[model samples]
Target: MPTLEVNFLGYRIKSPILVASGPASHDVKQIPIAQEMGAGGVVLKTVVSDKFDYMRYWPRPRYKLIDWDKKMNGKSQYFTLYSYEQAYSGSIEDYFKFVKISKSTSNIMIIGSAFADEPKDWIYLAKGIEEAGADAIELDISSPHKPGTMQFETHFIQAIKSVVENVKIPVLVKLAPGPDVLHQAKVCKELGADAVTLCNRLRGLEIDVESQKPILHGYYAGVGGPWAKYYNFKHVSEVYNEVGITISATSGVLNWIDALKYIMLGATTVQVLSAIIVNGWETIRQINEGILNFMIEKGIEDLEKIRGVAARNLVEPDLIVRWSGEKKSGPRNVFDDW
Candidate 1:
């Protein structure tokens, strides 16, 4: 069998499929479930400091699924999710326990995730997570539901530098998607981040036109789904072409093919969330098997053969020649032309 192993941030992962930090990884017990389902790693839900408010308005954590058809019973080929779920509510100590226990019991990588109210709290939590025996630490600075988080963009490099300095394990930053993604990726590399997750959810809002109000507690929410894949792929490819930072592509993977597209665009691994939420953990094995089967059929021995191949050869848009052919004229009706 062709080897499916991949090297990510000095650690060897069994596969390039990792469960993203979200509801699939909200509980410690879910880690083993992900492992059993063939995931190579799991980023635990964002562990916030005690002072960070975890509560949401009544009827919070709501979701509206946009389907290909109006009836909403169609396939998820065009699925899109708009949601307003907050970060993890439990204390840091509780998350530490989860990481420690999960590391002991499962062979898959247990990446501890943290986001705090203050920059100092980030360092404190990073130290605690490293000590708890996590395989790596993911600094979640991209959560849209948390206000005042992205406002620290000016200090992001400094904050990431502090965590990288404090932690013994690899440090990765989960960045928000925007025009600044390439800039942020370069900054993270210069600041010593071992890897950069391409993005979290984009902040968006939906209107119930009849009610003349916003959906989900009448506030802007984070949005993602299958439709977002191409956008994420473009960013991943652009960042790889620019700085070549180790990238964990997230936000729009729904199947093995989607995962392959990200890998081709230079993603070290593809973190899946919306797919698992809709299809369950079995999708993990399905993705893995699909990749393995494709590799064997193509006589591909390793993922490196295809990673970033497309990005490396990408042509500049400005260099392309535009079509200037005259429009063809035809008779108004087929019978008249005959």
Candidate 2:
């Protein structure tokens, strides 16, 4: 059988599929469920600093699913999710407890995630998570809904560097998807981040034509769906080609094929969230099985064989070999003459 085991940041994991740091990992019970469902690991929901007020945005969280068919039937697959949500509401102490419990109860890796306003707070949480026995720390600096709390680019790099300096465990920076992603990943790698999650949701707005209002709480919210997978693949491949850092590919992975695309683009692991929210936990098992079957059929024995193979072949458009002699016998479009 092909081995799915991966050595990520000096730690071995049974599989490359990880439950992303979101609603699926928000509760302690959910962590174990993901483990039982055949996930390789779970990134706990982002825990904020003690001074951060959770109650202010706790009244009523909003989320909506937009389907192409408009009927919203089970058979229809494509969807766009619009959500207005914030960081984890629980206290840091409680988050520590959750990490400890997950570690004791499951063999799968447990990654503690955190985000805070101050650099000192980032260090404090990273230390606490390390002491709590988390396998790694995922620094969440990419939530699109929470803009005010996000640090400036320079400050973000400084915070990551400080956390990496203070923690003995591996630190992974979760970055937002944008033109600056490649630069951000390069900075994190230079500052000693062991790995980087390629992306989080993009900020977007949807308007209701008749009501003249926004679909999600009248504010721009985090947007994601199957359509975003193309962008995810493009960015992940580009980052791998340029920065050459270990990547935990996140956002827009909805199936095993999507996961495979990430691995082929040099990601050490693939994180899933929107798929689980749309489908169910069984999606994890199905994806794992699909990968295993595909490997068996392809005569491949290890993930390393395919990792970054496509990226190695990527070349600039101008460098592509082209046929100098033209004028084939095929019919041409009217625009070709113009």
Candidate 3:
């Protein structure tokens, strides 16, 4: 039998599929559910500092599933999860208690997620999370719903530095999906971060045509779909190529294939949320089963054998064969010479 076990931040997990920080990971009650569903770990819902207290109150009807009913081959296929959901809807103290209780009750790895602007606040939250017995801490600097004008340059660098310095546990930095991702990942590595979570959801807006207004709370919301994995896949591959930091790929993993794609592109683990929201908790178990079956068929005993294989094998642009631009007839690949 093939094993789904993978090591993340030096901690062994039963599977590489972690429940991403979102509504599915907001409550302590969800911990046992995730473990039972065969998830390796859960990045607890991001908690904010007291200064960002207003982020705790999310608007009612915050979730909207756009194009969810679209299907192919008699199966629901694509969707855009647009949401205005913010940080964990609780005080920092409440979050501390939540982490403490979850850590005590759950056998699976529990990582506490936190978002804050100031270095002091970052240290405070990191200390609290460490005190709560979390196995690790992930700095949620790239949350789409982050407030005010906190950029990675002026704001997050110091906070990340402080958190890494203050915490005894492994520190993972969750970065946004943008052109600067590789640079930010390099910075995380230089600052002593143990890992980087490639790509958070992009901030986006949807409008109602009839009302001629923004839909769902009249504000821009975090947006992601299955297509998101493509760019993040590129990001993971590039970051893995250049920065070489541990990566926990997230944003658009909907199945075992998606999970395997991340691992192939150099991700140590894959985080999933939108899939669970749409497909139910069984999705985790299903993905684990799918991966195990694939490994067994491939005659592989461990996942590490395939990790980063695709990234390492990427074809350089200069080496790619290009079409000769001589009015070619019939069908041919863009890279194929006429």
Candidate 4:
């Protein structure tokens, strides 16, 4: 079998398949299942400063699918997508118990996903996570569902800056893909973010025109799934080449092809959130199996070799060795050349 190991956010893992921060990773019970199911890493469900503040271990909310490409600027149709109206809420003490149980594995990364409403809250949570035996921290400053919930790159740099000053472990800031993506990542690095996860979610909504109502109960929510992959791919490519921080591409990544494309484009490792929701935890093994098969076919033994391989090709598009390319003029017979 081809070796599928990869280094992400300064830690080497058995594979590049990481479970993104979501309800799937909210408890210690899920962590072992994730590892047993062949996940390369697990970013723990986010822990907020408030423990038992609102609710405790709320059941993972269900997702509502809407046409992902309903408003695409061009030819694409039928985006596999959904909206999450619910967000997890737990107290600090419950999260600590979660961390303690997740630390049993020496290799699987137990990443503490966290956020805060104030600068002091950020610092306090960072210190707590460091002592909680978490391998690293995924600073989730980019959840689009709760608009004014937590202060991240755009709303409040000071909060992130506070956490950076307080933590010694690797910290990754999740951000949205936009013109300011590079700037956001740069700012994160400037404030001591070890790496940047390309996006949290794109704020979008699906509405029932016939019923004249919003499809989700939350009024609006972050859009995710395979449909978001193209935009994520472009954003990741731009950041990899333009910025110096390590990038973890998320959003819309569903298969090994999507994962491989992200690796070539400069993401050190990619994450799967919505795909996991749709496909279940077993998806990680399938992803690893596909990645290994591809690597073996290419006579490659490690996942690291393909990392950022695509970034170098962006400058010289004609120099690409395998995949065929055509100058995309517009919507006109784009597939005609194929």
lDDT scores for all predictions? 0.85, 0.86, 0.92, 0.74
**TM-score, one value per model:** 0.91, 0.92, 0.95, 0.84
Q: In the order shown, what is each candidate's alpha-carbon RMSD?
A: 4.3, 3.0, 3.3, 5.8
Worst 10 residues of 2 by lDDT: 52-61
lDDT (10s digit) by residue, model 4, range 1-338: 56777777667788777888887887667877888877778888777666324433332343665554464556234455655633346568677767777887535877887766777877878778888888788877777655455444445588777777888888888886665787888788888888898887877777788889976463666677676778877788878887888887888777788888998888877788777776688778888888888888899877667777887667556665543565455467748659
Clashing pairs in 2: none
Per-residue lDDT of 301 in model 1: 94
Q: Which structure is stronger by lDDT: 1 or 2?
A: 2
* TM value for model 4: 0.84
Error in Å for residue 71 of model 4: 19
What is the TM-score of candidate 2? 0.92
Candidate 3's residue-wise lDDT over 72-165, tens digit each? 7765667899999998998899999999999888899999999987789999999999998999999999988886488999999999989988
Candidate 2 lDDT over residue span 74-113, tens digit each: 5545688888777776778888998999899899999999
TM-score head-to-head 2 vs 4, winner: 2
> Which one wins by lDDT: 3 or 4?
3
Backbone clashes under 3 angstroms, per model? 0, 0, 0, 4
lDDT score for residue 22 of model 2: 84
Off by over 4 Å in 3: 323-338
